[model samples]
Target: MTDDAGLLEETAEDLFEDAPCGYLTTRLDGTIVRVNRTFETWTGLRRVELLGRRRFQDLLAPGGRIYHETHYAPLLRMQGSVREIALELVRADGSRLAALVNSTLVTDASGRPRVIKTTVFDATDRRGYEQELLRARRREQEIAQHLQRSLLSGDLPATDGLEVAVAYRPAVAGIEVGGDWYDAFWLDDGESVGFVVGDVVGRGLEAAATMGQLRSALRALASTGLQPGPLLDALDGYARRHGVGQMTTLAYAELRLRTRRLRLACAGHPPPVLVAPGARPELLGEGRSLPLDAHAVRSARAEATLTLPAGAGVLLYTDGLIERRGRSLSDGLDRLLAEVASQDDQAPAALAPAVVHALHDPGHADDVCLLAVRIR
Candidate 1:
């Protein structure tokens, strides 16, 4: 052979044998026929012991072996190639090494399958780092869930002739808490009850913290016997001065048991629904203004009042319930009123969940809260 030809052949062989990644050729059934030097080095096994003796899958862990049989082999045969398969390989010392593998099926002259060529990349460091990230993410979600529960934990006010119930659901996206909150508590007079449904502007841990602060603020303000309009005024002032729930939308209502009277105010919030005895259910959209802290100089928020005659109920919910994508607000509102009218005879506790569940869209990623109050 010419000296230049010998040099070129030697260089080609050296490159194949010493490549950083492992390379191997196996029979159609995965029996190893040719393996590069890098493969032997990574497995810590001698070529004499592997050639004609072991199959490629023999070095895989049990789960990876199953994957090879069920997925890898079939995919390669069908697609003629498969890429980036995650698997674990058992080395000579029985320790498992994380690997990413790719394979191509070589065909014979008549296009029949002949052999398989595979390349393996070590992924120990990458797999470990990915696992660590997942663990940290899971830990964060757990902490947020705990915090969300603690902030929302409380019982609704109970009294004679007056019933209140709430249905609170986080966004459908799993493993995370959202900013939607509902609260029902008694004012200082103990004869009047407060109903609130608020949606903060953001989500996650910070949103939970903000929701807690706003909830506490509402409870404290309700203790002072402020009317719904003035109460929202106070809350807007709080949001502006404290910078906590800026642009937060909420509905506030005070229901007096003796008079069966309800006064409600809305700030950039959906109007509350009123279901009257022998009358149709409809939304009270008159009291709404812009959400809190929406302008540099906020204007006075309006409030509406109505006597809750016997068998009348009020329903308040966040926009997540009736503000679906591609659907008009009027349409959603009509749907809500129709559902409530159909089921108005049900008790408040049962009615609240049933109405919200009927309108819930699993594909929507927002919190849903429903507060229903009935005066007997």
Candidate 2:
């Protein structure tokens, strides 16, 4: 034989035996017929131990073996090839190797089934990368949760003749934190209390930060003796000027403890619910306007005023309380009103949580926030 022919044959053998990926040829029944040196080295098995003594699926983990038999084998037979199926292989030392496999069904001259040729690529690094990404996401969620809880913490305004309570629940089905928040405190007058329930525009850390900013800005604006309508207007200005919370929705109210007078305004938020003594619960639909910073040129926001009878109260909430899949806004509003009316005449503290729980939807995917205030 010529030296050139011998060298060509040797190079081909070397390429098959020492390629980066493991290579194997099996019979139609998956009995190993031939395997390259790379496969033997990867599985910690000798050629003699693998040839005719084991099958490709036999080297897989128990779960991988089941998947191979049920999906991989049938698919390869039907389509004549399978590509990039991830699986785990149990090596001779009982260790597992994450691998991606591709297989081709070779046919005879008449196209009858012959042997199966497969290549296996190591996938440990890829698996590690995916796991690290998941861990990072989890860490971000934790930090956001902590920030949200801290920002939402604090005491609500409570006095002998007045009561305030709040309840907040995050989305149950998603990994990202939402931007729902509630706050209640005394205005500078010390006789009237200011309370609000608001929703910022986004999710995660950015949304939580925006919620904090808007809450602080609203409180500062309210303490300056701004009524509900003008308070929201000024807040709109702040949002537009600072570029923080555009299109945010909220219901702001100020209640005088002595006179039992309440003033309220809603900036594209759900209408507040009114619970009056010896009267049916109803939504306060007046004093509504577009969401904060919704328009380039703002219009005058409206405010409503009414006297609350003894034992009367108001409920302010975010959209998550009355928004649901497959339910119209009117239907949700009716349901919330019904739930509120059905609850026994109770203090704001117990009433807030009870009403929230009654309207709770396990499938809801946004934050729910409600604030209840009552006059004795």
Off by over 4 Å in 1: 1-10, 45-49, 52-55, 65-83, 104-114
How close is every model to the real structure, measured as TM-score?
0.86, 0.83
Clash number for candidate 1: 0
- TM for candidate 1 is 0.86
Clashing pairs in 2: none
Residues 1-376, model 1: lDDT tens digits: 6998977766767888888899989998888888889988888977888888899999999988999999999999899999999999999999888999999999989999999999999999999998999999888888878888987778888877888888887887756788888888878887888889999988777888899999999989888878888888898899898998888999999888889888889988888998888888888887787888898876788988888878688999998899788999999899988999888456788999998899999988888999999888
Q: Using lDDT as the measure, which candidate wins?
A: 2
* Global Cα lDDT for candidate 2: 0.91
Top candidate, metric TM-score: 1
